[model samples]
Target chain A: MTEAVLAADDHALLKTQLSSALRRQKLSAFLLVAPLLIFVTATFIYPIAGMLERSTYSPEFALEMPRTAAALAPWDGTDVPGDEVFEALALDFKDSKTRQATGRLANLVNVELPGARGLIMKIGRGVDRLQPPYREALVALDNDWSKPEIWQALYGLSKAYTSRFYIAALDLKINRQGEITTQPEDKRIFLPLFLRTFWIGALVTLCCLLFGFPVAYWLSVLPMRYANLLMILVLLPFWTSLLVRTTAWIVLLQNQGVINSLLVWTGAISDSNRLSLIFNSVGTIIAMTHILLPFMILPLYSVMKTVPFSYMRAARSLGANQYTAFIRVYLPQTKPGVAAGCLLVFILSLGYYITPALVGGESGTLISNMIAYQVQKSLNWGLAAALSSLLLVGVLLLYWAYNRLAKVDGFKLG
Target chain B: MSLPVYARPWERLWYYSLRAFCIIVLLFLVMPVLVIIPLSFNAEPYFTFTEGMLKLDPAAFSLRWYRDVLENGMVNQDLPVASWAWLSDVWQNSQWVHSAKNSFSIAIGATLLSTLLGTLAALGLSQEAMPARRFIIALLISPIIVPVIVTSASMFFLFAKLGLTNNYLGIVVAHTVFGAPFVVITVTAAMAGFDRSLIRAGQMLGAGPLVIFLKIIMPLILPGVISGALFAFGTSFDEVVAVIFLADYEQRTIPRQMWAGIREQISPAILAVASILVCFSILLLMVMEVLRRRAERIRGVTPA
Candidate 1:
């Protein structure tokens, strides 16, 4: 009985130690992973969150021209209100050179607000500093400072968070009636550019697949010794600058380029170098496909390397023709690689900026180019952020869709 | 098959034709870069037909353009003063050199930091005790999935607000953000086939964690680390969009400088610069391939 009691005591001791050990393991894992986790969160997650925040960022026009914005808030949009709102706005306008500030507010009102340019010009010429004349001029325009439409606009602009940027990006707007409506017919098509961007990306991906697949297959079938040598040929361009490659295409495809000269020399075309290849869709595709071809081939080759030849040979021995044997046996095995290559090419094509910007001229520009112009030229960070967020969301959705499809297809690529 | 004579003359002809077509395609792929290298050395600036297109021209070589580029002083577009006084006074300015330094600094800082972190993460991940390993793996590589442009734009606003956009630390941090994913991939791959007991043996010998890492783990995974560093350097060197938006004049990188040059003008100077950049990247790639082969040898993958 004493020995049994001792054994029970030993079991109790072991249980206590085991539980503590388990807890320590958990703590250790948390410690090990914590630095990386926090780093990612602080550097990546936080920055993206801040970007989303900037999308809704609004300049404090209310603080600067409170009297004007307040006085105008109660006025109706269709008819001019009591003179106080206008007077206050005019006073503020006279008192301040708020082109940068007021232009943002105007964009909130309408991106291309009529007379807003004049407002900027007036402010630029009139307001050297905040003075009595400026205030007096503002007070003389109108008195009612609480017009609903004006307040709505101001309120929309006041918050550091609002859907206005995204709404504007989609070519829709909040009407004076406080309802979202389609933009004017001519202006109702912001989404078309986005659609066009996707269309171009898809077309480029298709082109790469069409061109890349056969070459990749040929490389796969070639002797290993020769294939390795040829693979270097594919990779040689990667050593060159992307700009150099794109510019080389520009040199080759231009109207007075080697292609034109050769075609004319061969009598393939008439004397006139009629083809305007540069600064067109054809140039954009040709350059981008050439640049991205390796991306497709590499993934396909990696997949093909592991596939056994016996599967095809077995199918052939079963009375299938060579084409049928290859298709039935070899092709099924390559689906995963093909999907991976297509996804890589397609997704990469979506973010292309330089090629499209350089080669596409007016019509071939992608969404990224527009975003760049907005940031650098127009100085429209909010709109740029909103558009980028759309793109980010679009890419994320695509990745998610690809993950789902890849799982179903059982294809894998790093 | 030989006894049956299943293949006809036309079939053999078709196969041979296909092979020839493949050869031509291979030649097409190889010719462009080959053409550019020689063109870069041509005495004449234009890319017209060479004197001996099929035959080698020993006398046609000239370093005049390269010398002109190196000897001429670089002047600021905004200000006419010499950028750098040495050689052509252009080299006297710190713009190109400073930017190159920044790129190197950021790339090296990012690569070293990420490689260390990735190695540790890989060790922790390889251990079965780690919870949610698959989820963590996915999250770590999420940057590879997100489009770089969006990342750059998003980071631009974030950094500008934080006053980090134009700073060296900011660029390092941005580079590190992208660089970590590559390290994780390569180092994880290296560790995938690594033996666990070698580390355990070190532990049993009373070696500390740091000691084991240095003495045992690092040697085994050094190739992956090196390759990851090469990739990081190349990425930071070639990266333009982020650097363009984030950097001002003081922080402009080489790629950014080249990009501006390209957009604004076409010059033989750019060709010289391109050739230089190409040489640098190829050197890095060659070093990487050597290290990779060494790593494979360590892992018992026989070299072809």
Candidate 2:
């Protein structure tokens, strides 16, 4: 009985020791990845979160013109707000810090209210000489100040957490009746741009597949010596600078460029009938397909390498014709690679900025180009963020499908 | 592909046509880069080949465009090429030189940062005991998968808030985030080939973790690590969108300058820069090919 108790005690001691060692191993492993994990989170995740936050969060007008926003907040939007709201606006305009600050507030409001910027600025310019009853004076300074749409739009901008940017991104706005309505026809670019972006992405992916399949099959069937050499032809461009490749396309495809010159010289077409190749959706698709063709080929080639040739021989021996052997037998085995490559190229093309922006002229621009314009030119970051979020969601959804359907081990590239 | 004796004439025709189609596709892939090299050397200010160039006249192939690459932004263009003032002016005032410096410095900083952190993370990830490995792997590599515009736009907010935009360190950090994934991929691939028995033997022999890593794991993974670094360097060097969003004029890189040149004016000086960059990439590709072959040959060898 004493010996049995001693054995039990030793067993408990060993169990505790083993558990502690396992814990140490886990801890050390966590410690190893912790630095990079934290770095990615800080620089990558945090910024993306901040971008999402920016789309829904614009407190500039509300915080900058606090009393006016607060006073304008409670109106039911049935009509023009009372004199109290007008007095608050007059005071806020008069007491605002700088001309730029007033302009900034006016700009934000004008995005929703249309004519509010000039009206607000007019009232601000003429406010110093205004009388005690500020409502009459404010409306007199600019007749637009009395409009219910202006007041309603101001109320919408007052909230710290807003849907205005997202609404605008969807090409909708809060009408005077305070219900969401479609943007005026000319302002309806984002939704259409998003659609066009997807269309371009699909078209480019189709092009890549059509071109890539033959090359990948050729590489897979070739001897290792020639395959390796030709693989460099594919990869050198892959490794070349994106700008360099883009420059090459521009040089080759412009109206006065190499391809057109050769065509004109060969009498294939009249000199006046030069093809407009670059700066259009056609160019966007062509350049993008060229840029992304290797992405499709690489995955297809790797997968095809593993597929045995005996399957083809077997199918042929079973009285199938060559085309039937390929279609019935060979193609089925490459579905996973096809899916992976298609999804990859499609996902990549959706977010393309530089290639599309450079080659894509007025009609050929993608949603990403519009987002860039919003950020850099218009300075409408909120709308930019919202549009980006839409694209991001689409990409993430496709990626989720890729994970489920393709069974991707990890994202591998050279 | 060798034909079987049972092949018919139609089958032979189909096979040759397929060969022709692939060769044409191959031309489509390579013709653009090849076409640029000859046009970049044009004596005239035209993008298309001149008649003289076609005729192989020496007058049509002056290195003037290459000279223009050096002298485009020189403050004193009239100074003699052999003079010290001209050389110094080229160094200080040339637009391409400044961009080249910016690209190299940024690429190097990103390479060092990525290679170090990525190698460490890869080591942890290669181990079986790592917690939430799949999720972590997905997160770490998400930068590449995420649209760059979103990433750049996203990072713009952070950098703007932190006052990190308009600085080299910000671009460096941005590139490091991008390049770290390649390091992770390559190093993990190398570790996947490593023999667990060797590491176990080290443990059995009472060698410490650091000692085993230094003596065994390091040697095996060194080629992978170096190639990964090159890939990282190449990535940062070639990247433009981030630089477009994050960098100001003083921090412009070669690709950005090329972008402006292509957009605003079509100059063969830009093409000269392109040729130089092409040579540089060929050098990088050669090195990578050698390293890849070495890694394959070394994959399953047991360390003595």
Candidate 3:
């Protein structure tokens, strides 16, 4: 102590320096990751936020027809607007026609008022002849122009931010009373499509498990040389192009294709009755199951590889048969693997786009295909965004569950 | 595992049946990929095996489809071999060739980007002093977890607004988001068993951080980074969803062209492309296997 005793203030200052060093290390580590975080925000996260905004904040009509919107804004919406509002609408329609913005305005209105697209386009087409005394003249062009309901629908479209697209996504409608209600029986497509999607996902997951279990067990129990060779089979499929596999399935499942050809040649089935396989649920299930089978096997094999062989032998010595040892003794230990594989396959099948789009025709199409239809064919980006957002929620929830079970640091891709 | 001589007839039956079941399952996994290779050589423009093909007649196989890939868009395909004009025409206008060029360029660009960003983040996350490690890792990996359609559609909207759509750069950036997760996962996995004492040793030996990284750490993690790069390449190469949503006709990639071929008509030309892609994937698979084995040998001193 007499040689080099530090003062009390100096000791406190050293402690402060040590803690500051630790904090500096933490800060440096965080800074290393910051570039990627910032990059992802700009490229990915911001876009997703923008699309969600599109679902509710579409201003196609309100932005294009301001005068009409303002005139309609004061009405109670219980009845059609008077001539003053109609004059504003007629003039706005004329301006929108000249600006080439009527198509968008009509498309927005058509989302709320079904079968109104042709009427609005027709009105826009003939807007040059649309004279004043506008209410009677507009109503004379089409009875629907005078109906309080159509006007009320158009009034809803007048707003910049609305929830109508989301309502339509749920297969619901907004009536003249401005209340949420179910779509008529024939119009309810999405809810049923979503249920079918989940149903198909479960089916595919079950199929993967059925095929994957024995194969995974075989790979796990075998010696390393043999196990590694067999694993290549699984990995090859995992690495193959999705379109290639889908094309292969098409070649195998088409009526003039391999399986049917072989079946007919072997006299197992008549040429007149070649199986209807490629363009239906059967093709989708079979193709998806084959494509996803390796996903199930890889995880199961990884888990089973760690299980000691002695446990099954002990179960056998304790008066259990091979089947009982496997069912009771072995499988219980592989629960996490089972859960992981099922959840992974199910999650994948739910959001599957290529296989289903290629092989799943009509009744076989899932919710993903419907979203594609909205984007490409129907040109309903608002409804498409809404549906995708819902799908995102479901997938995210399942993903969170999978993380809890697998506890994988990050997902391993083949 | 081989069957033990328990001397039970039922157990013998069970063992044989299980083996048979597993063989069929393995066949299911491997056959679809192999099935196309032979079909691609069909002399007839048919997907199914003709009688001659089944009999392995020499005349039943042709390279017409492969020839088609090169000749489909060439202005003067009949020009003599080794002609520069014909070659340039093929390079510029051949549907499959042009798409292939675009595919490789996009894949390479995306792979480089994702590998750089993902490896850095993975390294930072591995640091003992890293804060909120789990949450940051989850956020980075969410790109993989999210559905491709949602990602594609979302990016389409934003990129449209920013004037980033219909260009190779936009596609590259979108694909990097998809590709980054693979790089991050593989690199993080490789670093999980990394020894920290080596870093201290390097420092004590009077080495700088950059020197130690390049001379020591890079060697150990190169295989991981390489495998991750391959994964990223494959992810971008195999992707068609983003292409469908984001790219115009001018920026078509292989998968985009393939999608059109499938939808417009089922063509043997597609089979040719599929055959090429399958072989490419096999090469990729072999490289990955090599990297995995290298990693194993490197980690011999560590816990499995």
DockQ of every model listed? 0.40, 0.59, 0.69
As a whole number from 0 to 100, the lDDT of residue A309 in candidate 1 is 71
Cα error, residue B236 of model 3, in Å, equals 0.5
Identify the superior model by TM-score, candidate 1 or candidate 2.
2
What does chain B score (TM) in every candidate? 0.83, 0.95, 0.96
Model 1 CA lDDT for position B44: 65
lDDT of 1 by residue, A218-301 (tens): 777767657766776777665556777776776677776567766876799986645888797788877888888777877788
Error of 1 at B189 (Å): 0.9
Residue B245 CA error for candidate 3 (Å)?
0.7
lDDT digits (tens) for residues B243-299 of candidate 2: 999999999999989888877887888888888888888889899888877886787
The number of clashing residue pairs in model 2 is 0
Candidates ranked, most accurate by TM-score first = 2, 3, 1
**lDDT per residue as tens, model 3, B198-278:** 999999999998999998888988888999999899999999999999999988999999989998898898999999999
Among the numbered candidates, top DockQ falls to: 3
True contacts kept of 1: 0.34
TM (chain A) per model:
0.80, 0.94, 0.93
Write down the lDDT of every candidate, Cα atoms only: 0.69, 0.87, 0.89
